[model samples]
Target chain A: MTVQLDFLKNVLYFSGLDLAEIESIDKLVFEKSAERGEMVLLEGESATDLYFVASGAVKVFKTSAEGKEQILSIVRPGESFNDVSIFDGGPNPASARAMGPVLLYGIKKNDIEAILRNHPRVVLNVINVLASRVRHLVSLVEDLSFKHVIGRVAKILFEQVGGGQMGRGPRLTQQEMAAMAGTAREVVGRSLKALEEEGAIKVDRNRIVITDKEALKRVMEVSS
Target chain B: MAEMPGIDREKCDGCGLCVIVCHCGALTMVDKSINIIETVECDWCTDCEAVCATGAISCPFEISIE
Candidate 1:
């Protein structure tokens, strides 16, 4: 198989597999593509395969009865998704939609199960992955419960841009931040302005650069 | 569609989308679940229900004004 070795070596899910083992997976995997705004997996539908983003982004979200899209997360390249439902053999709790033209490697659920059975180490790695996700979700819940909107926005910015000072901050628009935070765009704008006034961050066009990581971290730590 | 009166404790992921969408603060997350703090003054416009992808909120069978 002519699969990209770098992608295989770098992807967390496939990192453990050597060339031969990866080749076996390659045989079972096939490439798929989707246009922007297209649904990859619909909510309440059973997942048939596990997908890894080879390129582009996908948004995992659920729509309310009133039709508002609640974005769970925006998945980027090298991330694996659909595993939650695939492993449980239950219908997808949420849906995934392509954020743009997306390239993915899809492996049948049965093939992955077989791989895990034979490659016991892979199962352990999967457990670690799931545990890490659970930890992240728990943290998200805690943040939503106690942290104010500004803190949540700052924390999100920190996660996306890291601790380094950037000449130009994140390129995300306020609307995007609002969607991610499950809040309104105006609220995100107000929070960003407040952060800028404190010299904690600076807005450059669409981006917001963090002036001080330690201060922002402090803000995230402050309750209520 | 009639507005969902409130979330059943058994459901609701507490994702905060309902609170986010409600122009009114009728919906709030409590103990990782949604609670309708007030049902009156609820526009009954189904705005919160529109955003609940998990189907956690069910519409009130009958609307009663307080």
Candidate 2:
């Protein structure tokens, strides 16, 4: 119970809550474990809970009629997903799949609703989080429509490096990079090769090293 | 449909990303190649597939949750 309280404190929606409030919430949440590639929630299913990541990651994605997957967001530790579904009292907007062996803590919609009724401050924090999600979606659409394939690839690389917070990041497969970049895998491969040749990045073993930040930035925001 | 996860030998570049993320300890690196140590007990966390930069590991099945 104490451990759960610590984890809940890190969540953006509940971060500002006092110790007593967090303790109250700790009782409402339940634990779930999902293996990698397992679908945790299905699109169009009735939403029941909001999930927060404790460890590992989750990918919120949508599938077209033809079954092509477009990942909308990757929820990392200290973050949550399915907020829109739970709050709006609607079907899941997208399916959630575990990116790895993920441990999650979820609060039922009814439990969270009760908390929201009592805590107006939490509603404000939730609104801020939703607004940020909207901004991220807007940027995603803009990237898909306006950016060239190379630019998109560069953008993905930039983000993988903790948005310039880290000089290196896990080397992603071309297929994974293409999914994030919204381009063909071949295009992503070509882009990586180009970046490598230009000394903008170096793929050493299992990690990607940002060799030149300025060069990478230039490619990420390509005007053409 | 292939419900079981399988490693594509042609695609597996032996980067061992699969082994690193397998919380189940089912995958191991041998001779610079990935080998499934426990074929049946895989917790199916698909991290092996997600982390494989070469598209080598894949679980061609989706768990239906209702």
What's each prediction's clash count? 11, 4
**Residue A223, candidate 1: C-alpha displacement in angstroms:** 13
Show the colliding residue pairs in model 2: A35-B45, A36-B45, A36-B46, A173-B53
lDDT per residue as tens, model 2, B1-66: 213357888899876656645766778888998887655556554556655556778653221111
Chain B TM-score in each of the candidates: 0.71, 0.76
For model 2, what is the alpha-carbon lDDT of residue B60?
Answer: 37
Error (Å) of candidate 1 at residue A176 is 12
What is the clash tally of candidate 1? Answer: 11
For candidate 1, the per-residue lDDT at A215 reads: 71
Indicate which candidate wins on lDDT.
Answer: 2
What TM-score quantifies how close candidate 1 is to the native fold? 0.54
Per residue, candidate 2 scores C-alpha lDDT tens digits across A115-214 of 8987777899899899999998887666556658777777777777677776546645556776787765444545666777777877542345677878
Interface RMSD of 1: 20.1
Q: What shift in Å separates residue A24 of candidate 1 from its native position after superposition?
A: 1.1
Model 2, residue A12: distance off in Å is 0.7
